[model samples]
Target: MEHFVVSARKYRPQTFKDVVGQQAITNTLQNAIENNHLAQALLFTGPRGVGKTTCARILAKMINSDGSEATSEEDFAFNIFELDAASNNSVDDIRNLTDQVRIPPQVGKYKVYIIDEVHMLSQAAFNAFLKTLEEPPKHCIFILATTEKHKIIPTILSRCQIFDFKRISVKDAKEYLKYIADEQGIQAEDDALHIIAQKADGAMRDALSIFDRVVSFSGKNLTRQAVTENLNVLDYETYFTSTDLILQNKIPELLLQFNSTLSKGFDGHHYISGLASHFRDLLVCKNPSTIELLEVGEQTKVIYQEQAQLASQEFLLKGIQLANDCDLKYKTSKNQRLLVELCLMQLASITFDGEKKNSKHFIIPPSYFKSKGVAPIPVQRPDTISEQPQEPISKEPVTEIKEVPEEVQKPVIEEVVSTPEPVINLSITKPSKSSSGLSLSSIKKKKEHLIKQMDVIIDEEELPKDDFTEEQMVSVWNEYAQRLDKKGEKIMASILQMDVPKLRDNKICIELSNSTLKVELERAQYPLMKYLRKSLNNYDIVLDITVNEEIEKKYAFTTQEKYEKLKEKNPNIELLKKTFGLDI
Candidate 1:
């Protein structure tokens, strides 16, 4: 059997030109080497798998080359000394290394020492090697590479030329993977490679490692499904499916999809975070200028654009917010899965049209119902109530009217003839009462509907303004208050009975102890005013409420105040208090 070589090691960059995604660093090194300005001590620092060690080896080999084809093939391994600082991070090791630094290269003009994970060296070892590192032999060159630059001492940093290696970008990584697939005679899908690159997260070595595993799992025919399955990653299709379900307002299907994802052993955190990114990507696809920001295969980009068209900016923004909130709360949430489920449900409801989700905030235009062949219902009120009843007309045979559905009654009401009585045609469509269990949103919509109904203005000039005494108005007001008491609105009833109504022209003014009562009475005034108008036959009557703090002082709210009131009523209370030495 032929020995299998991992793509990471097999396709490693051989020269500066072959290095991926570090052109700036590579060019600088090459230029320095060409000009003989290469630092004797060089520190290469960055994240893992981003070519710190690889570049060191390449630089070491290139420094010894004479630019001839023959010398180019020579790796000059004899002149290069590699050390793993993690395993040999002691003062003794530093002493031995410094001892070696004194010896000149036997094969090359300059000897190269490459130390990997240099930050692992102990403080003592670092101190021991600082002198040699600062003043190395003319023939010795040291290259230090570390993932964590902060751990290295500042003195050592000051003595070396630092090169910051950046993580490989997804685009560059995907293109490189494509080249590798072509070289290996493998048929790889673009989306499959793109996923691999994304999974690598800007590390070329990791990308190559993932590519090898995926290729081994799927053989020569590399596909997106095989890659995702091998990597145990949620595919782009999962998020696409999720987004589609949310856009369609399919909560059940979205939850089922989430369950399936969880069943596949994915973390709820991962799912929610990916969903947020999916929303962000969709938002990016919304505009032509931002399409380049989406890092996906061309096919997936087109799919994103299509989905973006289906999602409104508002929906996408809100979807992202909800998904992100779920992500942030996932770790702290005791019921993590439930938290994610709720987030998904909210996302699905973002674009929901059923039940008039936004009815509390927005009223649907009447034309909307008219467009659907429905007419507004007109409510009629008698302009004037006759003081005396008319005698019954000679019994004429009357045609019986058949009962019809409310839907049919709507159109019939629209066609009603204009009479002496005024008709109010409400333009706002009334939402049907939900038979489902109570919810705050439903309660809010009902309250808002009632407020809107009360807001409908009736012409005061056309209404009856019959003159009535303050006594009659007070009687009707107390009757309404007593009715409210029977109906369990004791707060409002108490507010009404706090003071008698004082008639000022058509206005009935009532003073209360505080502003809170005023607000409550105002909110409940619609029903109260309706009752008073109907009873007194005065549609022009209005309620005026005011708050007087003095009203609160008139009534004794505390024992001391009651004692003071008693003393004011009779001087004997004060004399009794002096005789008994009462606490009051």
Candidate 2:
């Protein structure tokens, strides 16, 4: 078998231009070499694998200027020493290095020393090197590299020039990965490369490692499925499927997909994490400026752009929230599957249109996402009730109600005449102290809202005689059932099910399942009575709520009892039946 060197090492960038997505750092380094204005002690710090040590090596090569392998001792232009502080962290090592620094460069004008992971050095070693580091020999230079800059003492940081290496952009990383893929003559799908880039997460070395591992599994033919499966990645297909279902508002289908994912052996937490990342990508892909941050293959990028066109920012935001909620609740939930299922259910309900209200706060249409600002969310109070239908009153009350038209009454005038009902505030909108120590505007707004509500209530005072029909009563039951569901009151909903209500003599008699329900009805009796009296001008007609036996239990008829009832009810009917020659 022929030994195959992985694409990562084979296609490693030799020149500064080849380094991915870090132009700023490369340019600064190149400038320092060209100007001969290099700092003696340089500190390179940032996240791991973002080219801190790599840049240091590059810097070392530039300083010494050896053959193609600038790392060789024979190629040393001066005296350039490279040390791994993780291993050579003793005071003896530092003392020896310091002693050697006093000697002049053997071959070149200035000597260079490079130390990787300098934070690993012992306190005594750092103390030993401090004096030489602060004011070293004129012919000597020093370079220090670390992933965690904070671990290094501030004293050391102040003495050396600091250069921060930023994370490589996804766009920049993809280009480099492409260069490698093309160089290796590998048949890698764009999505395959995108998976490698995403897995790398802005580290060139890590990207290379992932690419190598994937190549080993895929051989020369790198397919999207091969890469994702080998690396245990959640495929873009899953996200695409989920997002499409959500956009279509298919909650059941969404949950089915979620169950399918779980059956495939995917972790709930991982699913949530990927969804968050996917949403993040969609957010970044919203504008041209942010698209550069989206790290995926060219083909996948196109797919994302298409989806972004399909998805609104509002949808992404709400969908992401649902996904995040699933993640947070995943661990604590006893029935983990149900928790995840609920999340998908919630996600499917999210409409990008401004009309979809935030389950958290306000409801706005998805169209609102397109606009520059948000429409204020309407207030909701927990105990608040909407206006009830008109009452059925006697003919006299109808005439009184007909008299109050043709008035655009103002609040300021109305408040003085009638005591205004207080506005229902579900949220705490407590007035804050203002310049004069009282917020009159806030108080006025509350009072005004209250007055308006009272006016609406007063408007329903005019009742027609025998106003509500059975159909109307059933409709009210259904509406209240839905309201109870929204409030998570299943108990109340079940009782409302026995609500085959009828309008009897202007009073509503709702059949109950049992006396328990009848008791609940009685508890609600006062509000029901007041509302009925107001809606129907029949104060004399009282509600005769009863637990009707037929409503309570379903019974079967026995043959003997049926005969007895028939015989008792009609003695003359028997003689007439005998005359008619009738048989039972």
Candidate 3:
């Protein structure tokens, strides 16, 4: 049997040049060592697996080297020392380390002490090591590494030179993994490597570890499908397919796809969040300058650009909003699957024309009707009505007719009854030669006259004129007011209920305290009148409103007035007030 080694340990970088990302920190360290300006006490603070310890080891070895090939080849293991502060975070351990700092190096010019996880040291230990760290011996050089810099005491931080390390980028990590794969004689796809890099989330060590696991799963031939299956992650194609379904407004298919995802053991939250990211990526690919912001394989980038062309800016913005909202509501929602399905349906409806219908702001989509096998009927405009030609009328003796000016005369059609002797009386008026003066007020009055004439013509039509008692009218009026209240029109309902209706012939008269109430009722009279007439079965129903300022004045509006009114109602009320010494 052969021994298997993990890629993280087997492919670790040994030199400063070989370190990925954090080039600024690495270069600064190299220059400092070359210029002999290296600080004796140094602190390395950053996230895990970003080349902090590797750089520490490389720095120790490089400083010991005298620039000769043989010196560089020598590991100088005896001169370098490594410590885990997490395990030995005590005053005695720090005291022992300080004691060893006094001894000179056996092989190297400077003895290097590397303390990993330096933040774990106790307060007493930190205080004990501060003085030695502030003024270390010439032969001893200290290098401290920690993931959390704030945990360390401020006094200790002040004594050592700090270096902030950055997380490795996906591009740099993928390139490093590719180099490793080539060295191991393994064939890896670009997308497969890209996914591995992204899964690491800016950690080189984690990326290498994931790469090793994926390589073991798929052997030498590493494809995207194998990588996604091994990592249990939703692939880019899944998101791409979801987005396409949303763009096409295929709600049923989108729901099915979501069901499949859940059946495969993926969470609805994960699916929706990834869909939001997919929308963001498509938005990024919309413009040329922002294309670089997208982090995907070259082949996938082309696919994204093609999808971006089909999706508009408005659709993408709305899709992102809906998906993100669903994501936030997922955990709190009672029906988690239904919430995600609704979000998917909304995303699918973003670009659908039928969803826009009469207004773009309509929440209920027209597709609901189509799904129920209902076809929407188009409404026709009044002007679209066709005009039919009339037949010629037989000449007869006119019995009676009204005259209009010759210049403004329009044809009037009348029905004639056949008889032995038909009588017709027609009269014509000559146009006046004098022209009328034109003014804005005159034109307004003329318009009002025309409107009144049209209303009279409409009112002349025959309609039902059934009679109803005042009690019936009042009952119907109260019912309408209650209906208004239920519909959230409380103000209108109160106004309607303020006074009872009085029937005088076909006219229903109402008296209100002020003109404001009358005006409000008049504005909303059409629907009220329609309901009243239909309920009473009387087409001749008319609502007459009257306002009396004297009636308004009779109501007790102030405290003194109310007190006077109460005293007038009962003479003993004044005695009760005086007996109680009540102030009004």
Q: Against the true structure, whose lDDT is highest?
A: 3
Look at candidate 2 and tell me the lDDT of residue 456.
28
The top-ranked prediction according to TM-score is 3
What does the lDDT read for residue 55 in candidate 1?
Answer: 90
Give a tens-digit lDDT track for model 1, residues 1-584: 99998888899888888899999999999999999999899999998898988899988988888886433346567888899999999999999998888888778798999999999999999999989998899999999999999999999999999999998999999999999999999999999999999999989999999888888799999999998899999998899999888877666678899999999999999999998999999999999999999999999899999999988999888888888888888889999998998778777766756334433223233333343453233222245334476455444422234556667667755664334344333222333353212333444566676546542334456778788899999999999989989999888888899898899987999999888888988999898989999999999888889998999877636887778778889999788878999778
Q: How accurate is candidate 1 locally (lDDT)?
A: 0.84
Across 319-434, the per-residue lDDT of candidate 3 in tens digits comes to: 88888999999999999998888778767766766422343332334435344453233222335434566345345312234576655453321322233233233333543343
- Candidates in descending TM-score order: 3, 1, 2
Clashes of each: 0, 17, 6
lDDT of each: 0.84, 0.73, 0.84
Poorly placed runs, candidate 3 (over 4 Å): 70-75, 355-584
If both were scored by TM-score, which would come out higher, candidate 1 or candidate 2? Answer: 1
Model 2 CA deviation exceeding 4 Å by range: 1-13, 66-74, 280-293, 309-313, 331-334, 351-584
Tell how far residue 223 is off in model 3, in angstroms.
0.6
Task: Indicate the residue-level lDDT of 332 in model 3.
Answer: 97
Model 2: ten consecutive residues of lowest lDDT:
397-406
Displacement of residue 130 (Cα, Å) in model 3 is 0.9
